[model samples]
Target: MTVSSTSPSAQSSATRTQTSAAVSVSSETALPTSETKQAILTQPLFVYNPEYIAFLNKSLATRSPEEILEWALISLPGLVQTTAFGLTGLVILDMINKIRNRRQLAEHPVPLIFIDTLYHFQETLDVAKRASEKYDAPLQVYHPQGHDNVASFESHHGQELWKTDADVYDYVVKVEPGRRAAIENNAQVLITGRRRSQGASRAAIPILEIDSGVTPAVLKLNVLADWDYARVWKYVQENGVPYNVLHDRNYKSIGDWHSTQPTAESEGERDGRWKGEAKTECGLHKDYFKMRANYLAAAKKRKLTESTDFVLVDSEEPSSKKIDS
Candidate 1:
């Protein structure tokens, strides 16, 4: 699919409100009851909420990356800044610290959330430590329940699950745990450093958004949705922001050690990730429907294999029924 990238300047308040109202209209029309809205308000916004996409699109349209960041801080009072310890997100954190410093919001600075897939690089862990200290903000880390470390994970699910079953690996490592963490933390909004120029999947990203079924919150801000690689680098240089050292080695996007790879000068960034595959995200920011469909496809394939094996076993049974006359 040819996806178009939207810059934040393309959004307007009128457009945002109208889009939100349209969502409200569609939602109410579908439900035909005030009680439904109330019920939905309590649940994740994206579950049935239309405004989530509206906001994502609008914010990315109207504001600059920096402006979107400011709005995220202002719009979501109970916002939680989340990241997979990637380069782009770190830039947001750097800017956030600067904003907080200038505004004297140090006492209640925004907190950072990490999924801690337990397969990250030592450098990533070290960067997390350095970042937490630098920002002087609360750091909440979450990991998969059963698998606490890499060795444990490998022992449970043979090594190279990414190659064998990438979707499952993504769901367990990134998607589900992220949802749980946000919910448990009682987050009203989430701030991500996702930018449109990153890849095919994220091209149409909006700046301000609701998480739809993915998150219970009313808003999930992609504060830098429009930022290109050049702008990101420029911002970092201008602010003297500390970043993960991996970027120097052509690792544009950083994730768990097993999943990420460096890009070559000619191949373009994001090449190493999901190499030889059309996949971009690791079941994180894409729509819930897509993620579910992928999971189901993988599950069905596995089931089919099992069914075939069962048939073969039954056929191979020696004289079980005396040739079944």
Candidate 2:
């Protein structure tokens, strides 16, 4: 669901309507009807309500990331930012700090949500730790189910889950945990570091969008949607933000250590991710509900089959159980 184009003042009023019975907006004038106020409140989107998407796309078209974030903090209640602490994520983290510092706000408006897949490189975990301390942003870290480290995670899910099934890999490690974090924290809106220039499925990301990607879709905003890698890198460098040390070694977009690889400039920004596969997104930006259902089904099948399969005492010595049984 989306709103139609309206003046900034009128849109600002629409934001107030979401919270109160009064149809109060920016200017003194009121909108025509009580029904108009109801429509604004009833929309599926949490953040995109007051301003039409077109209005946001055009008005915020030239605004800096800081400007966009400022509007977001004011407009959306229960806002949270999720990241993997990649270069773009670091850039936004710095912007959040700068915006809050300028407003003289005692507390950060949006808390950070960092999902620990338990398969992340040690460097990625280090970056998350350093970013939380550096920005002093209220940080919320969510790990996969009950696992905190690789050895435990591997024991729960078979070794190299990604190589076995990328869908299950994503559902367990990213999609489920991300959704859980949002709900657990009461996150009404999720701001991300996605940029249109990231290429592939991410090439068409919008400035503000309803993430129909997940069931019970959440409102998402790509504050840096207009930026490219160069812009993000420049911001990170100038601000001296904490970033994963692996980026210096050519890991462009870090996920698990197994999936990521170094990329030449010619290979494009996200080519190093899920390398050699046609896949671009790691199911986080896709339909996660569909993937979860499939993963569970496959796991059930595996469990039933494993119970019947006889283990070999040695490579040359099979169990005495009948092969047919």
Candidate 3:
């Protein structure tokens, strides 16, 4: 979807009647049960003790990304990769392809999960399709609940929702969809593309850590955590990995079209994302409980407003009818 030029406040204040219903339905029906949550928490496929995880991080620190991937493939259960088709993710995808070829495997061992925010650049979309096809990896794509594309999303939530309420927008477009993908895939470990060089919240990220944001904590393997932007670019060039074309235009890190921009040569890789904002990582990598709470609160307020308006209209209709009669 193309980015709209209208300012968020200036955008039409369309009532979100359909969006409220959708949110209510999803909150009621899509959330996992207590038993299911317990199962996901207690019945982990691998040991996730803090001490053991620390040991794994130290052990994998000096190893190559490929080596890390190989170890994870054999050891980590329910492993999957989440990507936005950035340079780092593409490098990992290429490495996975090489690993699969060497092992003579028919299918890539680890599948991929992509959250389509419906506001991504056209270049990002093209690369996702191309990379998945090239690697023969299983890609499961998820979107915001009730809406399939940008037009429907804007029609219900109003145009430029991110400008109006960023937290609510992030929850709907990225956080919720990512959580759903994880649950549906039964993912216990996620291969991520985060790196220390990205700065901000990622400056001191370890090679692996337990992600407690979502229900039933899952392991996140930053296979490229120790790698720098130069190294990542070198690997991408040597391996000819498919990546977003925006990189050619100075867009170092890519997200939704509205929030992403091109970084200067001296800037950090992710400087292009959410430029001028204090934000770094998207809500997908943040606390799921907090984001959900905020989104639910917003939805409740909207519902109440809609209900109030309905009552007022209903009460006035009879008087107007009597006057007419």
On lDDT, the leading prediction is: 3
RMSD versus native structure for model 3: 17.0
RMSD of each: 13.5, 12.0, 17.0
lDDT of 2: 0.69
lDDT of candidate 3 over 1-325, digit per residue (tens): 0112233421122422332222222212332334554465467244345554555576677677887777666555567787888999899889888877877776676667778899988888888888888888767777776566778888778899899889989888887777766665567788899999998889998988878665333688899998999999989888788888888999889999989999889998988888899988788789989988888798788762321111222232221110000
For candidate 3, list the clashing residue pairs, or say none.
Answer: none
Model 2: per-residue lDDT, tens digit, 1-325? 3333345543465644453322122323222233443454456654343345555556666666776776666555556788999988888888878866776656665667777787789999788878877777656766666566778777767798888888877887788777766655556667888889988777888787766746233567898998889888888888798889898988788888888998996778888988778898887788866876787787797762322111222235312211110
Decide which is better by TM-score, 2 or 3: 3
* Span of ten consecutive residues with least summed lDDT in model 3: 316-325
Clashing pairs in 2: 13-25
lDDT for 309 (candidate 2): 15
List candidate 3 stretches off by more than 4 Å.
Answer: 1-47, 215-217, 304-325
Least accurate 10 contiguous residues by lDDT in model 2: 316-325
The TM-score of candidate 2 is 0.78
